[model samples]
Target: MGTWGTSIKDNDAFADVYSEFFDFYNKGGQPEIISKKIIEDNWEILEIEEEKNSLWFALALAQWETKSLDPKIISKVEEIILSGVDLKIWLSLGASEQDIKKRKIALDKFLEKIKSDRPKAKPRKRKKLKTPIFATGDCLVFKLSNGNYGGAVVLATDNNPETAYNLVVTTRLNQSNKPTIKDFQNTEVLICNFGQWQDKADVTWYMPDLFYKDYADIYEKIGKISVDLEYDNKNHDGKGYLFKPSWTACWGMNNAADKQFESELTKPKPKKTLTIKQLTKKEKWWKVF
Candidate 1:
């Protein structure tokens, strides 16, 4: 979350890394210039976006494909194993379960090969969150006890869900009548597109059926709903969300989506049909056939 979060703002560098990663994959699985050291040095940038999952796993795959390995390379491989990124997320990158299994085996063997050369370091494991970190631009779908369903875009994420749930969601509803992060239950969270909110005038509430049907393919299961993420008025003597006085009514959300909502809702314009008079004689004659 340090420098890794900031450096990906450069679109050029992002595109280069993305294309180079694919190119490296195509030419050979071996990492010639993009060694473990290079990845380690630029770790902040590489792991900046959601692409971090892909970047880490790709390195693992490339390492496995390389024919020869030195102690230094093995050490770097070890660093990858110790990195907190989950190897399973590679599945989301189109890797099959069998391939992931082989990758794990290869990683294990590589680690064993270098055991004598370097002492084993403690593995850095990621904490199993009650709910996965709901980062900005994530999609959230919920079905409450009332049996209604709807979804929204995550405007921001709260790393620590203990003290306060830091979910700032951007909905289709106007800023005046939007649901706070607390107003959900039996929630089903999905890792949708890397989209953000933009252009307030464009925001409007979308019915449940329309949304799920339209964007059905992009959603992936990330985690479950937190039972108590929303603040309860009963618990804090009628204090609202985040225990702030201003949040006592209408929750803390206000015109949050007015600024903008950058999402995948841009529908393509329909192709215009040619009128009979506008068509050439030859084209019209062919159409008759």
Candidate 2:
């Protein structure tokens, strides 16, 4: 139900699988090895029918694109396509006749595309990103607009320098007054909420090198405060928004979009939304949902 459309690439399960495969491949992992690793990593999902189909579909596509398609994987994908279980699931889920027709065509097209040989995309030498710019729990302030101070706290840092990034969240720093270190602990995480999650947005990033060169004299390290990011999650129908703990940079957010975020977040506004309450209500940083 995470799917939004009939396209093979339209679901979160497919996006997660395909992207992870390429992440490993681009980092110099072998296709066969990466494929096996994905299979092993998602063993639990493999037990479910729809998820099982998504796995095969995604892995077959990735392997085909890399010119390392496995015979067994292709066979599994072919069976899933011909079995029409995906469309059946769609029908069971109340998909209209028109939607079911589109899904059927999508499945056929995917099968044909993977059967054809694709030019191999060569893996490049990757420079794993730099070490996290700030340590976990480091609260910092930056002067973005004239005379305005914006606050952010490092929520977490990764161990691998290649993928290590300082995951930070912006705080509700009012436009006119500078907040005391203790005030930051009371401030809410600034977020763009528009009823549904599809309308949610955020600006985040590791400390880019330009931080010193471009934002020099504006960045200040404040006293540390503990924080865990609360993300907006959408329902299957994309109708409702749910606040969940988000601990990684991979959440859908624009890198270095802080300047734009500051425009609205730095404005003086009373807290009335759900994220602050959710944070205080039995929320654990590591909880996935």
Candidate 3:
């Protein structure tokens, strides 16, 4: 819907549909199956008549490149183009006469490209899987800002070296002395609720970056749990994973591997709290509450 240019890839829907098609294709999905799934998954895109053009154009281009162009898809695009419905929609969206002319030219070129036969199909690429540094049941410990230590358990891994991350639960053992392997297994995890630390609502993070064996100066592997995972699974003891874990993730790391734990150890995230004096700017406002 957000159209900044006249090119097929200029629109948001086109880029999304095109990328998804290739993603499934690279994963060894059959072209017909991938096309159907893409249509089903993004059925909403087809609802808006204006947006429908982007999806069909993207799908057509992808299919053409893969040498699997479908007649029905080509026919749909052709109908939209020749009928001039796309240009009318553009005019409705307040496009200039010049821009509409350019879009029509682009559409004609696109139709010609897809209607032609490709000499060869583009090769399907293999998707690289991410692998985790620590195992599912591994116990980990990291230093906190107050010279105390924080505990964590590696609940699961998505087997990706970079992307698929480690699923971990931080423990509540904020301690000054170093804890042994036994301590990690016995302690309760930090649970957040109503923005404060407490009950049923908790946080489980997907961390692509983590402290590895080399970063033992600040973080280290203590041991493993899970007679079969989940640190809270009642199958292990009595308290299973009853809490609904809130999930979050971080993005755009330059080098997640070498710098994950090292950066945290050197400069950890600071926790700043405002005391009454700081809040009152050191004034005698204790009676103002």
Candidate 4:
């Protein structure tokens, strides 16, 4: 838990940084020259705010502290800080509706000042949006270790499942070369559905690379694998895949999803048995010899 006094101190530390930047700007010094060093020093300090509260204030502080050392920069920083203060006041202590209204008015004035002085650039044209390759309510293919394959239906909405989605599949061979889809043999494919809010839907896949060691291995082989999928969205035709054993896939979310899948995998499997009469019938057939 953090105290109110700590928040005040953090706020003051940010203010001091803003003051120093303002001083430099007023002196007609170049702020961009020291921007990198200043940012490195303040990164941890920024984390303090990021952990304790909203990142909006921290971003404003960063913008102020790193703005070009010029008169305009100082003015922009002050405007941003004032706007942040207004936002904090509104979110912190309970204020009367009238007080909220008044704060918003002041905040609007500060924003107007910022807009008047800020540099303008050409507006970017919007690109056409494509239907996501992976989406919610779609069946996904995954490889297992026994020279075989498995699949699951994607339950959560995935606006960008290829990059943002997390998943958990049952198999071994953390490395790509060791266990290809051919390794998954005689293993039952267990499919589980998870909602967007479910914790299990958040696992990410990790891969190995010589240069970038932190990368996750999402794709295993060069060739594509084909699989069937069912989609909730109506516009796109639902089922298709490119080739055999498409790529190494992993859940994109947190470890919680992995744990959930493991629990599901651990459930008892039903056993097969033969009755005595059936056994006797087989014996009778052998007795003819």
Could you give candidate 4's per-residue lDDT for residues 8-92 as a string of tens digits?
1223233334434434444554556544444565565556532222223333433443432344544554564564654464445
TM-score-wise, the better of 1 and 2 is: 2
- Residues 1-289 of candidate 3 have per-residue lDDT tens digits of 3223565555546766776788788878888999999999989989976688888998999999999999999999999899999888877755557768888889999989999999998898766555565777677777654566666666666654435555655555567888777776667644332111223322243433322321335457777765343333223222334444433232111112112222334544223222211211223568578
Model 3 CA lDDT for position 220: 74
Predicted model with the maximum lDDT: 3
Estimate the TM-score of every prediction: 0.24, 0.50, 0.46, 0.25
- Clashes per candidate, residues 3 or more apart or on different chains: 13, 0, 9, 37
The deviation in Å at residue 92 for candidate 2 is 1.9
TM-score result, candidate 2: 0.50
Candidate 1 ranges with C-alpha deviation above 4 Å: 2-19, 27-30, 34-57, 66-71, 79-289
Residue lDDT tens for model 2, 1-289: 2323466765445656776787888778899999999999988768865556777888998898888999999988888789987888766645558768988999999999999878775455465565656776676776533466667666556556555555555665645566567766676666653212232323243433223433345457778755454322222222332433332223222212232343335443333443333432345658966
Q: Which stretches of candidate 4 lie over 4 Å from their true place?
A: 1-14, 26-28, 50-89, 92-99, 118-289
Residue 252, candidate 4: Cα error in Å is: 46
Root-mean-square deviation of every model: 21.9, 12.2, 15.9, 19.6
Query: Each model's C-alpha lDDT?
Result: 0.34, 0.59, 0.60, 0.33
Model 2 misplacement above 4 A = 1-3, 125-289
Clashes of 2: 0
Q: Rank the candidates by TM-score, best first.
A: 2, 3, 4, 1
Candidate 1 positional error at 83, Å: 9.9
Clashing pairs in 2: none
